[model samples]
Target chain A: MIADLLTTVLVLAGLAFFAAGTLGLLRFPDVYTRLHALTKADNLGLGLVVLGLMLQAEGPAMIFKLALIWVLVLAAGATAAHMVAQRTWTHGEFERRE
Target chain B: MNLLLVAAAGFLLLTILFGLIRVLRGPGSGDRMLTAQLFGTSGVGILLLLGFALDQPALVDVALVFALLAVVAAVAFVRQHGLPEPAGTPMHENPVEEQPHDPPHNPPEDTHDR
Candidate 1:
């Protein structure tokens, strides 16, 4: 019972971080800042939530799945953010901003 | 457990809203691209939450593929069409600083559009 409660608390806390990240992504200016916000919170937030849930989960199968999801989050986040930033580079959108 | 999953999914939905707003009202194609990235993140969250609810491991494989695909598509598009610049943006700040540093870009007229 205590463990479940603790995990619940942790999950909720992670969710809060996710919320803050989303807000930062929306409220911040420019692609870099947006990417900065999105990557920080989304990655950590999801990671924590999965960790917290892993406590409640049973068996190696569940644990493996959770871990795989985290790996995907990390890999995908960097690549996509990079692509967006790359687009900004190729388009010469920066010159005018200068 | 069910209630917690539901709550988590709801919060994930909120993240979706933030991304969608960018898609709809973003100043340019690049902005829209960023918003689209949000969808992929939210989708991952949703997948995990669902897997937890169902106690299913197979879904994780699907999520993995989806995540990879989204990033690949984003990168391919960015490399191909170029990022769309937001209108009314200042012409003095070098926006390309956020990008990978490489090569010289030939100067061109400011093609500002709405």
Candidate 2:
């Protein structure tokens, strides 16, 4: 029962952050700010959801696999964010907003 | 029993949809790349959630492979063009900027007529 309750709460929390991230992507004024939102929140929100699922899933291998996936996602997502931000700036895509 | 996982799965799928919006309207290529990153992550979560809910072990490896692909995409972006340094971050707050210009170490060359 406790595991189920915990999973429920965590899932909701993860979803909240995920929503907040997308909202920021839409509402933020600039590319930098939008990257900030999407990179951090999306990575972290997905991490949390994976963790919650790990808590519920049986088998040590399964949990380990999910954990590995999260780590990979985090590394790749952050790197991609950096690259995109770099490319955008280099390409003069961001017009300085007042 | 399965309802919670299914609900979580739904939320993750919704997250994917939001990610699509970011990609579609991104102001630049960088934004598009990063938005693609989010989709990569969301996809892994979906696979895992489905695997767990269905008690299937096969999906875990698929998620792992997805993880590998995502990393490759990120590295490719970086290789083609290095990531942008964050604003206000001085890569090297050159103390040299504060120091006076140094004179040439070697003697000045003489212009002698041959």
Candidate 3:
């Protein structure tokens, strides 16, 4: 019962973060800031969701796989964020088209 | 518990839908790509939730693949377009000073060679 309760709270928290991230992505003024919003919030949200899921996993192997997915996402998200920021920094921001 | 998981997954799908608005209104390619990244992460969350809610372990493997592909898509975007300008271009305030020992101008040459 406790496990289920914790999962509910954690997963709901994760969903909140995902909503904030998407809001930031849509509302931010520029690419760099949007990158900041999307990458950090989304990955953290995924981590929390993964943590919640881990509690319900059937075995150690399943738990390990969940952890692995979170780590992979962290690495990939960081790298992609850096590359996008670098590209924007060097090439200049592209103008918004109406 | 299962209903909670399924609801969470549905909520995540809603977030993805919101992200698509950014893709449509985004000022630049980077912004659109960011939406794609958002989709990738959110998709993983949805799959995991559904897998547990529906009792299908195979969806976890699909989540694993989604995580891998997101980065690959970003890398490909960076490589295929919007590369930095040549060192001496007016884009940078002090390109030469910033990169004094930079390697020979090679992007164009490399493209030609390709």
Candidate 4:
């Protein structure tokens, strides 16, 4: 019962962050700021969701697997954001906005 | 518990729907690419939530694969869209490379010498 309650709260929080990230994507003025939104919020959001799922997961193996997926996502999100931002900066796309 | 998980997943789907608008209307490729990243991450979150909600653990593996693929996508984007830094704005200040008095880095020394 406690596990169910915890999962509910974590999942909802994760969803809220996802919503905020999407909102930032729509409302931010530039690509860099949007990257900020997507990377930061989505990373945390996914982390929380994964944690919530872990609570309900059966066996240590399943918990480990969930954690692994979240870590992979966190790394990928940071890497993708950096590479995309670097490309944009190098190409002067942001400058074009100004 | 199932209801909560499903509701959370549904909410994430809504965010993805909203993010699609940015992807469609973005003024720049960077914007689109990052928005796609948002999709990838959020998709993983939704999948994991649904996996638990539906009592299927294999979906977690699917999410792992998705995350790996997203990294590869970013790598490909970087490679395809890489731009040469402006002549004056060298990333490093090597004396051989950043000689302000010398000719710019373009045109090989041999080509210029000839």
TM per candidate, chain B: 0.65, 0.66, 0.73, 0.72
Order of quality (TM-score): 3, 4, 2, 1
Tell me the tens digit of each residue's lDDT in model 3 across B1-114: 999999999999998887888888766888888789888899999999999999999999999888877799999998767784444445445445456565576344233221
- The sequence of per-residue lDDT tens digits that candidate 1 reaches over residues B1-114 is 768976887888888886576677666677677667767777777777777777776766777676667677677667556555555456525676335454355233344543
TM-score for candidate 2, residues paired by index: 0.75
For candidate 1, give the DockQ: 0.37
lDDT of each: 0.71, 0.72, 0.83, 0.80
Docking tier of model 1: it is acceptable
**C-alpha lDDT (0 to 100) for residue B96 of candidate 2:** 45
Worst 10 residues of 1 chain A by lDDT: A89-98
- TM-score list, all predictions: 0.75, 0.75, 0.84, 0.83
**What TM-score does candidate 4 get on C-alpha atoms?**
0.83
Instruction: Output the better candidate (2/3) by TM-score.
Output: 3
Per model, how much of the real contact set is kept? 0.53, 0.65, 0.74, 0.89
DockQ of each: 0.37, 0.47, 0.67, 0.68
The TM-scores, chain A only, for the candidates as listed are 0.86, 0.90, 0.92, 0.93
Order the candidates by DockQ, highest first. 4, 3, 2, 1
Pairs that collide in candidate 2 are none
The segments of candidate 3 whose C-alpha lies over 4 angstroms from its true place after superposition are A94-98, B85-114
What is the C-alpha lDDT profile of model 1 across A25-53, one tens digit per residue? 67777767777877865588788878877
By lDDT: ranked, best first = 3, 4, 2, 1
